[model samples]
Structures are given as C-alpha cells and as structure tokens.
Target: MGRTFHRYKPQKIFEKELQTSEFYDCKEKKWVAVIPKMKYRFVIALKSDYPREVFDAPKYYMMKVVWKNGKEQVFEADTKDALGDAILRFRTNECFWNNLGRYAYRVYLDWVNKSGRLLQ
Candidate 1:
C-alpha cells in the first residue's frame, strides 16, 4: 500500500492574515480602541488582600460589589445573617427598594448564604 501527501501552497504576502481590531479603520490603516463608558457589575475578592497567616481562624469572607454606574459596596461577614444584613445596607444606600431590586436582592442573598437562604 502506498500513501500520497498533499501540501498547501504558501500564501502570498497580500493574502497573509492580520490581527483584527474592533475599532480599526481599514481604509485609513488605523485603530483607536474604544473603552466602554459604563460599568455594570464587579465582584472583588477583598480577602486576597490579606495573607492567610494574619488570621487565627478566618472568620469572614471579605468581599466587594461594584454595581451600576461605578458605585462600590463592601462587606465582611462570617455568618449568613451578617452577610444578608450587609447586603441590605448596600441595597438601602443605593435606594434599591423597588420590585426589581427585590429580585436582585434574592440573587445576592442566595450567593452569600453558605447553609441556606437568610434574606428570604
């Protein structure tokens, strides 16, 4: 039995692929990357800032949430109830007492509870 191998022809310089830019202007051969003006959400791990050895027994998950138009909210809690209260403080500060806010609060509540729903 014999086998035949096929080789692809080398592409010309004009046919070579190039990196694409979302903000590129092909006609002008220029690109200006655009940064979004709005920030929707952020989950920051505040615990990583401290070394593990600093704690006798780490009692809290230090965390931060940056939500809607660059507002930042921070919390440190060991228990589910504490976390819920912290989140409530944030929600209150942001004036998130509306119906939509309640739904979002539920989601955040579910996340903060290690055992079960505390804010519900």
Candidate 2:
C-alpha cells in the first residue's frame, strides 16, 4: 500500500480580512482571531502549537461570542471556514444568534444520538 497525500489550496479571502488583528494568547498558547462588533466580540481560536504560522484552514477551531452582559457562547468547528461563515452570517443579521444557538443544539443532539456518548 502506498500513502497518498492531498494538498489543499489555502483560501485567502477570509484569511485576508481575519489576519488584520490576530494575537497570540499566552494563557491558552494558541493564536486567536478577534473581530469586535458593537453587540459582542467574536473570537476564534486555532488549535495549533506552532506560534509562527497560522493555518488558513485549521483542522480544529473554536468560535466564541462574548456579549456585553458577560455571558458567552462557544462553538467548535473542524475547519476555519465553518466558523468564518457563522461570523459572516451573524454580521449580516442581528437575529442570527438565536438561529446559531438552535443549530448548535441540533448538532449536539445528533451527535449524542449517534455516538451514545455525552460531550465533555
């Protein structure tokens, strides 16, 4: 058997916009993307150990929304584009949070039903 490797071309469209204000979080030891809006602050953390490089499509990433009330909601995605799309959707619609939360809940239910394991 031979190992085959596939190379994916990095998508720079969102990366260009997101790269403007990325900073390393010493506490988490990961690069985090920050986009501040009037209602809340959107943050995306990439699961990478190397500090020098930021992958355009990180295999694991987390999206977090921090509102003025100090309550936060966190969502995890396997690719950066998924989180980016969520952010773009929210930016366009103020009511997107309700939909986002519903969608996340549905996904969680599906996962639990299929895997028969609770998410930690």
How does candidate 2 fare on TM-score?
0.31
Best by lDDT: 2
Query: What lDDT would candidate 2 get against the real structure?
Result: 0.45
Per-prediction backbone clash count: 0, 0
Candidates in order have lDDT scores of 0.42, 0.45
As a whole number from 0 to 100, the lDDT of residue 46 in candidate 2 is 50
Clashing pairs in 2: none
lDDT of 1 by residue, 1-120 (tens): 865444332221111111212243445655455355323242323233334444443445434545444575555566545655665665553234331234334545545463354533
Name the runs in model 1 displaced over 4 angstroms. 1-39, 42-50, 90-104, 112-120
RMSD of each: 20.8, 15.3
Per-residue alpha-carbon lDDT of model 2 for 1-120, expressed as tens digits?
975545543221211011133434555656566565224444445553333334554345665555445677776666544654544455444344442443343443443355454545
